[model samples]
Each structure stands twice: as structure tokens, then as C-alpha cells.
Target: MGENRIQQNEMSRRSFIVGAAAGTAGLAAAGLFSGCSAQPNTSTDNAEKTNSPTIPEEFTDGVYLTKAISMHGPINVKTVIADGAISEVTVLNNRESYVIGEAAINSMPQRILDSQCIDVDCVTGATLTSMAIQNAVSEAITLAGGDPGNFKGYQSPEPKEADVERECDVAIMGAGMAGLMAAWKLAENGKSVMVFEKMPYVGGCMPITSTAWNAQDTIIQKAWGTEQIFEAWSSVEAQLQSYREGRIEPDNPYYNPDMPFITPMFDAARDATDMMINIGVGFCPISDWPAPQLAPGAFSIGGKFCLDIVKNYLTYQLGVEIITEAPVTELVTNEGAVTGLVAKGADGTVYHIASKAVMLASGGYISNNELMEQYQPDELKFPLMGPPWATGDGLLLGQEAGAALETMDQGVTSHYSGAVSHAEISYIHYVCPGVVVNGSGARFVSENMEYKQALRVFKDQPTTDFYWVFDEVSRQGMVPSGNSYRLDYTFLLETGDATEAGNYQELAEKLNLPDLTATLDAVNECARNGAVDEFGNEKLRAMLLDGNMYAIKVTPTPYIAQGGLKVDPACHVQKEDGTPIAGLYAAGDVVGSVENRDGAMYRIGLTQAIAYGLIAGETMSAEL
Candidate 1:
């Protein structure tokens, strides 16, 4: 989802510029004028001559300023054009982090200047920043009366053939945390393992964010004195009830009949954590409510940390072979048994990996529009924010090999809790202590419902546009933890996504919510008197009054697919008749029913991936 988000952010920025230009045209027709027109000159004089191109006469000398949105926020650039050439390129302002965005900021502009073109290679690890600079420069060139498209500075790397190929005992698809862990385990057991990754680097979603996992009675949980929390919170009935909460229909076939299998899988998660720690993975403990047993029982390490340790151990210690930019195209099967698979390299070279066993840890199909429409057609209306490579490759391969899928309708949906304008950063405040209203300024779901449940209710809203209204006191208490605090409140305000007003009336006027003032009054009254509102939000009743108030509009975003190929508790791919597919195994997001126990509930994604990966690795190794 991290890589997908970065790409989406870039695409959105480009789209915004295009949309702005179209809007400017409409405004022009309406006799509206601005300081600068968005319409670009389409005259031949601004076009670049391919045979012998030179800087346009109009851009002979001047400084052009343009802004492009980076992964963090807007990046403003100053392009100095002098004597028919780019004399200097300077980044005037950006909110990018020094460690991630600095390299591109420092090196990309110089590359553009040296090459005398706007197109240049992006920094290896700083793709967003690099693209942002390129975009800013391109906008500057357009403003300078030059052909922005003709400034070809960034060049893609030449694709290379698969020069080496060999047989292995097991071939794993993907190099994500789950796939890497599976490779490490199998390789350590003296099995020759090969991993094929479609991406250039390891850690598909890892190295991009931090996530929590669920495990019971782990060393960390014991140390934190919360080892028994899971047993208390997670009973079989509770687990079943969790899955039944937010279904579109009561009779929907989303629930898994073999729901009890989750008990042992979570029980085995402690061993998975121990193995990860033994392999040098470090973790910090964090807490979440209601699911206390599931929350602090495991370690809270950033994806990058887990990826680094597992990748290093797999490559250097276990001697596992990993091929990046190699995507598995088909799974070879003989007499109903998996045998080998065909993969294509970046340069279109095909390599066949013959293996005794195959594991599919290739991730979910959230990024595949066709698959999303096929499985959960309703979800097609919502925006997806998962990795692009999660195109259901493993699921496709499994289906071709006679494996049945389960819980195809389930996926993770995240809420934009703060302000509609602050959608990008609203993910931070998952549980906003305030009243949530639809586009008509009327409350819908209870503000105190769990995040996932809230998402379900929000999705059903008439306009699908909502806001979180809170007082300054409640806002002060909204200090975020987890993978949510990338942007601060001030930044959100700067983006003009958040609305602040001295009183509810003013805020209502700004938000176009005619009934907002009355709604706010009622909510504030409930908060001041500790009275439960009609929504049964007793917890928020005491937290909403006093001081200035704010509103943040939010939209729904589906993060990861919760359904895929059906696998047994041992992580072996299973057919419809309740039999395992010989030599075929799957883990991670590729195995769908792992989370939606009864077809409704969701567990932590990383935990399910890791635990099942461990189980798959051990089971396959035992077969050897």
C-alpha cells in the first residue's frame, strides 16, 4: 500500500494540474480572471524542434516559479533561465523529510541543470521527491514558454535479461515480508529456495510503514504484563461476532465455517514472533483498546526493520537466491500436482524454475481493478491505496491450478476521520472523539464505533462525504500514534483541508452545512452534561465541549484485500473438496479467508501474514 500511495499521490498532483487548467478555461469563458492564466500557449514557437532544439526566445532570461505536490506536501521550485539555458534550479519550499526527500532535492536539480533537460532519472529511494522536482521543473518550463514534454531528462534504466537460472527445491513468489520469511525458513532447513519479486527492491509494503501484529503470550507481552489479555478478549463466539458486525446483508456468505482454526493460528503466532526475534528482528510494544489480547502480544517494528533483518538473513546467512523485477507468469502443474513455474524478467527473458514445492506469498488483488470488480463490485467506487504489484498474480495462478478462493468480497477499508479537506492526514485520527455528520450535517453512525465498523457506515452515507467535528479540547487530546502522524495539524490547515472557527455558526457557513450549527450545539450540550446522544456515544459525550471547534472532511480508502485463495491452517492451498493441492502453499495476503473469520471481521494484516508464512515454511520444509 505504501508504494501505491506514493504513485497515487504523484498521479493526483498531475491530475490536479490538468483539472486546474480545464477549470481555468471554464472560468475564462465565464469572464473570470486570475493573476496568471492556466492555459498554456499552443503555438509552434513554443514547440521543441527534434532535429535541432534550442531554448525558446521567450525564455531567454527569467525566473519561473511553480509548485508540485510531493509525498509530504507542496514543493515550490524556482527555475532560473538565462541566456537561453537553465542557469539554476532551486527548491524554494517543501515539507519532505530530510532523510527521505533530501537526496532528490540535492541531486536531481543538478542533474537537470547538467543535462539541460527537465527529464532525468529519479533518485533510487526517493521516487516521490524526485518526481516532485521533475514536475515542478516541468511546470516552470511550461511557464517559461518552453515545451515541458520535450525536456527529456529522466531516463529509465535499460531492462536486462535473466542471465542466470537454476532449479531449486522451492520457488517463492514475491519478496515481501511474508515471502522473505518463508524463503529464510526453507533455506535455513537446507532447502534450495528461490524468490521472484516483480518489484526492483525487496519489502513490497514493508520499509514503507509500520504496522502491528496479533500474537498471544509472546515474550514481549509477558514482559509488558499483558500475556493473558488475548484469552480474555478473544473467545470463539467473540471472534465469530466480530466477523458478523458490518456485513451488507445478514445472509451474506462471508463467514468461514471453520472459524475455530483462527484460535490455533494466533496461538502459534507467539512462536512466529520468537523466530523473528531469533533472526534479529527488533520490536517496540504498543497498545490498542478492546483487542488488548491481540494488540500488545507481539512486537511493533517498522516494516523496514523487519525487511532488513529477514532480507539480510535470507541472502547472506541462508544463501537464498532472490530475483527482483522477475514476475511469475504461470504455475506449472502435472497430474494435479504443482511442479514449477515460468517467470519473465524485466527484459522479457523467460526463466522456468523447477521446484519440488511452490509457495504463493505474492500479496492481494486490491490494485487490480478487474479483480476488485469481479469480487467486490461495490468496492470499485472507493479509492484503493495498496501496492500496484498486488494484482492477484498468486490468486490467478492458484485458480488456474484448481484452487478455490474464499471471502472474495472482503478487504480492509480505512476511514478519513478529521476533515474532508484533510483526507490525506485524517487517517491519523482514526477514533476522533466528536460527532460525525454526513453531507447534510446529520449524524449517521455512532462516533464511538470501531474504526472498521465506522468505515462500513461511512460507505453507506448518501454523499459518502463526512466530517469529524470536535472542540479544541478534544483536538488537543488527538495526539496520534502508529502509521498515522506523517502530517501535522498545522500542515493540514496549510493544505486548507481543515476549517477552524470561533463558533459553530461560522464553521457551518464555511463547510456549507446549513444544520451544522444546531448539530454542534446539541453535541456540545451533550458533552457538557455527560448525556448520551441518540447515537449512543457515551464515551464522546464528555469530551466534546469548550473552546474553538474544527471540522475535517474525510473519504473512504480501501487499503488491503482480505480475501484470496483458500488455505488450510497449515497454510497449504486447498481445493473445494477440502483437500490440499499437492506441492502448493500460500501465505500472506494471497490467502484470503485468514482475516474474515466469518467473512466480516478483520485482524491486523502484518500479523496474519507473518504467522501464516511461518506455518507455510515449516509445513513445506517438513514435506522435504
Candidate 2:
């Protein structure tokens, strides 16, 4: 099963007890006497005495819930209107159903605060806990002598103006595959859609990124196959065959979608061969050559053209409105419902649109320095490679409306062991002979294993630090399998950060290797025997040949933020105590990721982003 499905099912029953206890405590202290109106007298004093406002060890300095309130029965509770805004209810405990509690708590506060006190529906499976929290908070507020008649505890942000007031059924926040796919679906259904992008162009980290879609493809035979094409495509055909069989299940480490997904890649490749077609704003054909010549035989079968071409054709020819240089700011809520949003223009003006629902398709927080510290403080020290605009605006907007954050600790960043400021221009080679050493300068794993497997061994190693040691032979040229593992030679040669020595002894000395001779002996032994001593893999033996050598230090980097407005599968942001926030939903990377931080799955992050965006958009559009 996928990581998400497992998590959804694994939420223990203890969460229900915690939520129930908290609600009971809130009611007893408020002296509501089972649905009776709370009095502003000594009952609150007794309650306060029983439930002192002391911070628990788990929620030291952060904002946390300290109470839960439950009603006698499931009540169609109208949002508490206070000061023209809806009310917010914070759950003090974890006594409700796991997924339901989280989803409801995350959604309720925002809905109450935004709607200014109106009736809102409860999330499925969490209605009892939701009512308990809502009624208790209501009584608690009344006991405190606060105005409960007006949207009680919600505050609207100061209003801002927009540079453009264009109208669309859906306004996407990013132009990446997820956002683009959303626009395509909505547009295909005859719904007007607008895509806002912060980058100068489209393709959020995909154009230059090397990854395969996870799908199943049917093998096809072409009658006009040329020798050159056959030679170049044979390896790819074999790989695809492996994918078609049970060798590639959804959770497999090397699962790549073969059928429907690969079809797009091939289509994209074919489109690339013609006069570069316009896919979206700011995209062009990367090459104008025949498919077979793009790369050597089967090894050259990277279906870049397939995805790019389909992406381009849909954006340009399909009626998807993609507007670059726009960033969303405040969300517009009325009567505890999210109706639209306001985006900021490059000229410093705010633009507003009133849609039936809004989807947060913005990327993650890898690019935001402050957001990085708030969510993943340990990663702030490393060099970042994700796009510069992923500063957690989506998170901030959702939070402002009472959504709870989660995860805050899951991302897949390039791990180069050598001391370099930027990512290597090419993919790290799995076969290239190199020494994998921990921060203690000890060879910990086979240098020839898969990158994911190798890195997993070193993740919890002291300080999460490691380095890749290699000779010049493996670094200077293309190894077998069409992979260029070489670090930028010019950068290495010019900078000298990559140690240079005529022999292994000098290279070992510079790297502070404990035993230079032993490391060399192991490399040669592994090469001669066609096996890696630490991890047995034939692919490694072929790649690590003789070399002068290089070593690059790598520190762990977080590419995704796991925390943000907790939401249900339907994308409704929930409160801390299991109530739905009215009029708000979250999608894409800003929400808690479906994958665990250390799981072994291919395209997990991107796949979830696409799936959530797709589901959220469709749901919101259906509401329209």
C-alpha cells in the first residue's frame, strides 16, 4: 500500500479518547450543565482551577490548544459571529478519531473566522468531536464576557487593491505539471481557468529535471522502424518491458509509469522533432533532430519530448490561460466560506477574483529562508536548489484562516558529498567507482549501490553528513548507461575543491582517509570480482574504473515542508480539534505530504502533488 493509505488507516483509536476527554473537561469547567447557557460566574472559576492554563511539554512556545468542548448531541451549530467574523475553536487534546479529528480541527477554525458566524457542515466521521469542540468554545467565549453575537473571534486582514481584475472559474497558483494539468482538466470541461506564475516562464522544475512518470504502457511495433532507431531504442524497450511486468509495482524503488505516462513522453519527443511547438507561455522546442539521433540506442530513449510537447500543445492550443508574474496573497471569505482570492502584481498592486472555491497550487517552502527556519530548521544551513519562489505563501494564506500545519520534515534533495555551493550539473552516477565515507572519514557502504539505498544508510549517521570519493577516470567521461556522473569538470578543475593527485595515496591523504591502501584495495578487489564488497550490485562494478579522483561533501537538504493546514482528502483545511474551516481548501506541496520522509518510492512527491491538485480542483469546480 502507498504511504498515505497506510497513515490514513494507522491513526490509532487513542486520538478519539484524547479528543473526548478534552471536550468533557471544557464543558465541566464552563458549567454549561449539558447544553445549558454558560453563566459568567464562579463556574468558570472552578473550571479554570481544574484546568490550569499551563503549557504542556509537547507545545512549549508554539501556539497550542488547551481545551476541548463537546455538546450533548450532534448540533447544526452556526458559526459564532463576533465582530463581523466567524469564530475559531481550538481543540486542547487528541481524543477524536485520528484522520477525522485532524481534518475537522484543521478546517473548522478557518470557516468560523471567515464566515462571521454561519452554519457550516461537519466533516464525515468527525461530527461528534466537531460539535463538542464548537459548543465548548462557544460557552467558554460567553463565560469570558466576549461578544458572541458578531463573528466573535475572527479578524479580516486590511483590504488591498489589484492590478488586474480578470475573471476565471479557476486560478492556479503555479505553472508546474500539477497546476498545468489542473488547468487542462478544468479547461477541457469548458470551465474558464487562469494560471498565475511567479517564474518568468512555465515548467516548475520539470524542463531540466530528470525523472520518469509511474505508469503502465503497452508495447507497440512500428512497421517503418529504421536500424538506427532500433539500435537506439532497444535498451529502452527492454527497460519498458521490465516496467510492464510485475517488476515495477507502485511501491517499488524503481517504479516508472510505462503505459499512459510513457505515451506522453514519446508524444512529447515526437513533437520536439518538428518546428518547436508552443506548449505554454515561454516554452520552445529544445531540439530539432530525429528521435533516434537524440541519444544512442535504447539508452537514448528519454521521453523528454513526449511530456514537453503535450504540455506545450495543451497550454498554447488548449484554452488554458497562463499568466506569469502573479502571486496570490489574501484569501477572500464571506459568511465563513472561501469565495475567491487576492493576488499581488509585479507592480505592487493586488488583484482580486471571486471564484466559487480556491485551490492552493503553489509550491513548497524550499526557497523561503524564513519559512525554512519555521518548518524545517535543521535544513536552513544547506545550499538550496529548488525554485526560488517556494517560500510557503500557500502555507501562510491557509494558516491566516485557521488551518493547522503538519509534516514540516520531508524532502528529497541532491546529496553531493564534495564541498560544492551548487548542485552538480549532471546526475550522480550509481556505477562510477567511488568511496562512500561518513563524516568520521570511514567507508560506510558500497560506493556502487543505488543512490537512494546508499543515502538511506547514511541519513541518520552522525550529523547527516557524508562524501562521495571518486577518481578522475570516472569523473572526466561518460560511463556506460548514458549517465554523466562527472561533476562539472571546469568547476572542479578551476576551483581545486576536488582534490587532485597522480595516485590514490595523495587523494586519500587530502580526503583524510584513515587507510589509503585499504580503500584502493577494496576498489580494485570489487572491480576484479565484479562485485561491491559492502553492497552487492553488478551495475557498480561496471562504472568504477581507474581514476585520479574527486570527493564532494554532501549535507542533508530538505526540499519539502511537511507542515501546513491539515485537510481532509477533499482538501478542506481543518482545525486543531477536528472541525472543518469554512470556505478553505489546500492542495499541492504546501499541505502535509502523503509520503513519509524516508520511504522508498519513485515520483512520490510529484505524484501526490499532481493527484491532490487534480482532486481539489475537481471538487471545488463541482461546488461551482
Least lDDT summed over 10 consecutive residues: which range in candidate 1?
25-34
At residue 400, candidate 2 shows an lDDT of 77
Each model's TM-score? 0.78, 0.56
Best by lDDT: 1
Cα-based lDDT for every prediction:
0.66, 0.49
lDDT of each residue in 1-624, candidate 1, tens digit only: 444544564466556534322221111112211124334666555432221122344643567666665555667777776676778988888766442356578888899998887768766556667777877777666555667766774566677665455689999998876787788778878999999988766775554333455565566556666543444434434444444454323455644545544655665566777777777666654344323222212212245456667777888888998988789998999999999888898777788888999999898887776777667666544555555577899999999999998776664555442332213443434434567788878788786565544556776666866777777765654443322332334545544556788767677778899877777777767878888888787765543334577887766666676678888778889898879999999988888646574443664666677767777888899997
**What is the per-residue lDDT of model 2 for residues 225-313, given as tens digits with 9 covering 90 to 100?**
33323332434454345445533456643244534433233333332222222232222111221122211111112224434554566
Q: Give stretches of model 2 more than 4 Å off.
A: 1-163, 218-316, 409-414, 439-441, 446-466, 476-490, 526-532, 535-547, 553-556, 563-565, 568-585, 597-604
lDDT of 1: 0.66
Which residue segments of model 1 deviate by more than 4 Å?
1-13, 17-67, 75-130, 140-147, 153-164, 207-209, 227-258, 285-301, 347-349, 415-423, 430-432, 474-489, 541-547, 598-600
